[model samples]
Target chain A: MTKTHYFYIGYGLLCLLGITSPLLNPWEGATTVWDRLYLKFYGVSPYGGFSLLSFLFYSIIYTGFLYQFQLFLTDYLSGRFYYTAIRYQSLARWFIHLGWQMSYKAACFLVVLATVTVLIGLALGDSPELTVSVLSNLTVIQLLIQFLLNGWLQLMNGLMIVFITAWVFKEPSYNLIAMGLLTIAALPVLNAGGWLPAGLNSTAYLSGQWEDLILITMKLVVYLLIQLVVIAVLFKRKNIAFY
Target chain B: MKLIEVVNVSKSFKGIQIFNQANAVFEQGNIYGILGPNGSGKSVLFKLICGFIKPDQGDIIIHPSYRSRRADFPQNFGIIIDRPGYAAGLTGFENLKRWAEIRNQIKDEDIKRTMRVVGLDPDARQKMKSYSLGMKQKIAFAQAIMENQQVLILDEPFNAMDVDSVKVLRELLIKYKQEGRTIILTSHNEEDIELLCDQVYQIRSHKLVPVNTMAKV
Candidate 1:
């Protein structure tokens, strides 16, 4: 099987393990393998035994990794495709225009993913209080806006990393290490600065923290616009010859 | 009328000069051959005309009527330069389909017809990664002509093709020329140049020197 297929299988198994482990060992003091695994990674006790929160956090981070992996794969494949497509003299400018096309696709994928995950969460009979509180705190429109903002930010971040690395490195493989380093370095800053709203932090927006949401949304938009302009200008000036 | 004019174009890579004050002109409805040895700026010239690279000290001007602007690619351009790259996981038809979707100028039948013209199996399910070198070349050719563009710029397009395939492609190109499309091709093959080009220029000393095939004959 392809690496992507293996990844999906492994991710699905992990999700199943996360959900079922808590149910299997429901006693307050009893600890399951999932709890132990979570402790090892998080260095904290899993709240509520087989905590759905912990599982959700793990899933979000894993999804980020998956998104990055797919971005890398698509960039590599599209670069190869563009290497020849650009040869079609009329398509020489296509590399610059690809940003919007990819962003649109990523946005659609994010919406579908969010809807499916929410549906699955409902089906799994998540905590009644958790679901009620979440639903009560934010209307559907607010939730959608937040979800779209979060997805756009994620997409912009991924694109920025690829574009910056592509500008610097001649080989696409070199950008993998650069992407890893950038993600590692950016995560702590984004979290500490309250830029990224994953896990429990994401729940804050539902409780009428519109100010923070608006501020973050504005910053992300400005940053993405600047990055897009830089990428377009650089690509226009760069010589794209296959070696 | 001139379709493309390259005026005093100069280009270099990390201090290695490729072209210095090189100039060339291509008129409409003519097959122009650029003849040069390897690493002699034939490909560079093609890249300049295609707006793939910027010239250091000059401008490439595509006729305003043919192209929208001075800085943009000419409208309806079909080109094959270097190696043809495609998504490794996609079938040949899928790859072509993606490109066709971009412009929305051609239909599925056009794609299939071009594939047939290039002797590629349109229904083949094999991924592009598994395609042989000859198959890849044929697919690239299929992409170039599928749109029925007014201009074609091909760089060593016949590389890795068998004799029969090459003959078929040559005939196809001749047909494109007869239909009044401007075609520019770079080749080391003398026979291709003799049989195909209406006007030929040899790349000499970073400048184009016109060749008279009839005088030589």
Candidate 2:
């Protein structure tokens, strides 16, 4: 990890804290940890009308650190890729290790987010106990799973986007195509709830239904698998010409 | 004893051929020098030998004893192809430690010793971003030799170094060769080729042609 990685983590903490502060304050809002989490993820609904500005703000903030990960991949490829790649006997192993690093970083960020949310709830004198909420009929385990899967899968999808774009465009500037696709997917007119990459990140698409959540999980897995397969195929033959 | 053989290897990028049926033999306990002008596929040949890139038409055969059961690339080979990939925020010691952890074969003491060998202060707190080009090159050279790799494939191993540093590295390369390690390298300077390399090959017209070292000078 580099010094810049710490900056990204710090930035993520600040963003989480800023967003959580208003929603979990003692004066006028969510009284419990679960309530705070539920409200935080209560993003725009497609069936109901959507707020363009609010969705855009949350989406960008949520996925901003991911752009840094993409940039890191690009830099590593250009610089020390050969240095590291040759240490391993096979490039496939190196690629797998890279994927693992991304996954680990993604999981760590989610943990940090959750930890901050809980700490804020504690400071606000919100109850530590996970309580029943009328916001949606989600059990504690189900809600936790939903939150984790949504956050992790979104980050992984973001990584997949970087790899696919790099393979196709062979340059970092091509990541703009990924950003544009994300923006286009955010529009509610597409009605692409949980199917498109951007729509899959929306909490509203989760819908608190076991069947819906399961379906969404399957869809996310399938989408991520397809993207991973595409990347593996393209990258298998790619010359290590990052420099 | 033959170590790595590039048998009729051919490669191209974007329809521009880099090598065509190029073949070379690298044997053990010898420092073989590759000489070619810029864009003449010297680096590409090194990459193929290291399995960083595959040849389009032929195989790069590695001796069975050097082949690892775990990976497609040969085991126990130190390599320097392009830029050294050190984290700018990390000190030289920290960077080496991270890479050493990959193989889990060396300890902190080994790293410190290797740093010392390269004339770097192991305890220095200076980050890699603050390092001079020469200092970075030393770090790159340190990592390649730290594990005592049996084979070293270095491209432009003498790049960006002072005269004294180059001399120190030359003596070290001779010591390594004395230990019976296979070393293949490329350098723009004929002095490096003449002083260190036991045999030399010059790349011409997509082929590896052995140059009579004594006659070339």
Candidate 3:
């Protein structure tokens, strides 16, 4: 990957971090509702102590970093494939890469519309009153943009595996298995419900910046681990041409 | 109008002149042969007609009936220049399937029919890596004949073929000619040139001349 591309990804993370600082003090009305929900749900020991916007922002930026890491790493894997194939055509392979990005963004748009509709319905009480203002929901937009940006990057990495199998891979059957792994790794985390835990900021047993760094790093590490295994499994099959 | 016209087309390489000033008219249904020595610009001339390369100072015009525009060189001609290259990782059938999808020519059953015509194993989904040189040549031939093109240009189409395979290609070319399809084939072998060409052109000193009156036998 280019140095300029790496800078862009880092800049995106820094921008998200700046936007998330203001969620430290949410609206009083939003705070009261959260307090009541915490009391009813978890016997009032601050079960839902934080704002929803904070969690959403944290997950969005965290996943964004991992997404850039995946792109850089997969490019290495793809470069290996390109040199090994007897007559690999990058011209044809480009289309497969582009198609994945287009489809990913189209899904992200539908998800954004659905999130806004759900938030609006909950804020209103079947009257024509506009209770929730736009600025408070500003963090929601940040959550979605990061999802889409990272989602496309992950999809590109996934399709790179398919391209390698049909074009550069010496063995044929492993293509199917590698593609299965890619599909699972890139599945959207948005629709997994509360059971899977919120992506970046689930209430852990610890708190503060150190806890945040440890948790975020761990998530990034797991994401990279999955990608490494996928590449290694494909690379070590037999006489890996080392191209 | 002539089906295809080449007016004063010339090309040079470094300081050497290959085709200085050449003109030819090709009519429909003629089996024109390009005959010359090993480095006599036979392949270069074919590339010029296929629009793969450009002449230094002239225009090539295929008749409107032959093709609508110049960018559609691929549509007008079924050609082989230099050598036939295929994606070795893909099976011949898979390679042909992608080609069909690109060209919108020869769907499923048409592919089967073309395979039969060229005597290749349509069911041979084996990666082209396992194919012999002759088998790869046959695959290119099968692709070239897919859409029943009106004009065919082939450069040394039988370079790596065995006796039986050569005979099959000759018969295939003859069948296309019998249907009044304009064809051009270039080769150095006297026998192939004699058997396939109606009129032979010699590239001498960057000029193309019909070989009716050579100075020697």
Candidate 4:
């Protein structure tokens, strides 16, 4: 099998483990691995702790990063797909060529993941009342909007990191690490300096008060513009043959 | 009429000069071969014509009908520079299909025919990662010729091919030229230069100079 097959298989197994672990052990597993990682690294978890909503939010963000990383690895191994796509001058095709479909599939996977976690969380009676209140307080419409907006923001962030790394290093692993370090370093400064709005300051945007919605939306727009500008500059200045 | 004109172009990378005040013209419906030692800027010259890279100090003018003054790539051209890259996860046919979608001028049958012409089996299921070097070269050739572009720029197009494949490609080049397509190629192989090209030039001292075809042959 090709390396791509292996990558998909590995990703499938990870999603399976993340989903099933909750059913097997209710108290710990339903909180998506990303939330756990965020808790470990940043000393903060989305929504103040683990909940069904936080799990879904973190899973979506994690999926974005994983999808971007897969694209990076694919480009590194093939050395032709991204370059050829750029030469054709179609941004949509370029995204499709680099596995943008996977990100959409990841969204579907998160839905399934959230449902399974909710079912298992209720069945196991692990803070069932808390899950109930969380589900009720956030209506389906609000939840859907949050999912779509937050997922887009995460995907944009992921793409920006990949584009910046491709511009500078053109290597996948190093780029991933560099992006990680840069984010970790930048977030604290952005947060402390009050450059970002309160709702945009942390992954806690999922539970942000309704009044902060406008601020969050504006932040998303600004991030999207930055992503487009970065991609345009990268394509315009960088030589295809060099990569 | 001139199909491409590179007027007083100069290029350098990281302070290393590749070409200095290089000027060359390619006429319509002729096969032009560039002969130079490795790193003599043969590929760079072809890239400039294709608009893959900008020259440090000159303008490359393609026929007005084909491209605008500031376009980065010519509108009707096929090119293979350095090693051809395709998606490793995609089958040979799929890679070509994706590229054909970008051009939107060729159908599936065209891609199949081009693959067959290049001696590649379009039905082959193996991804590009599993392809041998010769197979990769053939796939690259297939992509370049599939769209039936008016101009072709091929750098070292015959690399890693067997004798028979090379012969087939030479015939294909002749066929392309016969159809009034302007073809630009670079080669270190004197036999290739002699057998295929209508006019030959060698890069000497960072400039293109016409060589005696009779003397090279």
Between candidates 3 and 4, the lDDT winner: 4
- Which residue runs of candidate 2 sit more than 4 Å off their true CA positions? A1-10, A13-31, A43-45, A121-134, A167-169, A191-193, A234-238
Q: What is the lDDT, from 0 to 100, of the residue A219 in candidate 4?
A: 69
The DockQ value obtained for model 4 is: 0.41
DockQ by candidate, in order = 0.32, 0.55, 0.02, 0.41
Question: Which lDDT value does model 1 have at B48?
Answer: 83
Candidate 4: lDDT of A145? Answer: 50
Winning model by lDDT: 2
Ranking by DockQ: 2, 4, 1, 3
Model 4 stretches astray by more than 4 angstroms: A18-140, A168-174, A182-190, A193-203, A234-238, B68-71, B214-217
Q: Where is model 2 chain A poorest over a 10-residue stretch in terms of lDDT?
A: A21-30
Question: What are the iRMS values of all candidates?
Answer: 4.3, 1.8, 13.8, 3.9
Worst 10 residues of 2 chain B by lDDT: B66-75
Choose the strongest candidate by TM-score: 2
Task: Kindly list the per-residue Cα lDDT of model 2 for residues A24-76, writing each as its tens digit.
Answer: 22224456777666556545556545655446545655556567876787778
For residues B1-217, write the lDDT of model 3, one tens digit per residue.
Answer: 3777778998876567888779888788888888778878887787677554567778777776654332324344676655555655678877667666655656788887887777788887688868888887777777667767778787788877788878888987888888888888887667777777777787877888878523211
- Global lDDT of model 2: 0.78
Residue lDDT tens for model 1, B141-163:
88878988788899888988999
lDDT of 3 by residue, A51-154 (tens): 44444443344344334434433443332222112112222233334445544654563354334334433463222233223223323333333334333333
Local distance difference test scores for all models: 0.65, 0.78, 0.53, 0.65
The TM-score of predicted model 2 comes to: 0.90
TM-scores, one per candidate: 0.76, 0.90, 0.50, 0.79
Cα RMSD to native, each candidate?
Answer: 6.0, 3.1, 16.4, 5.1
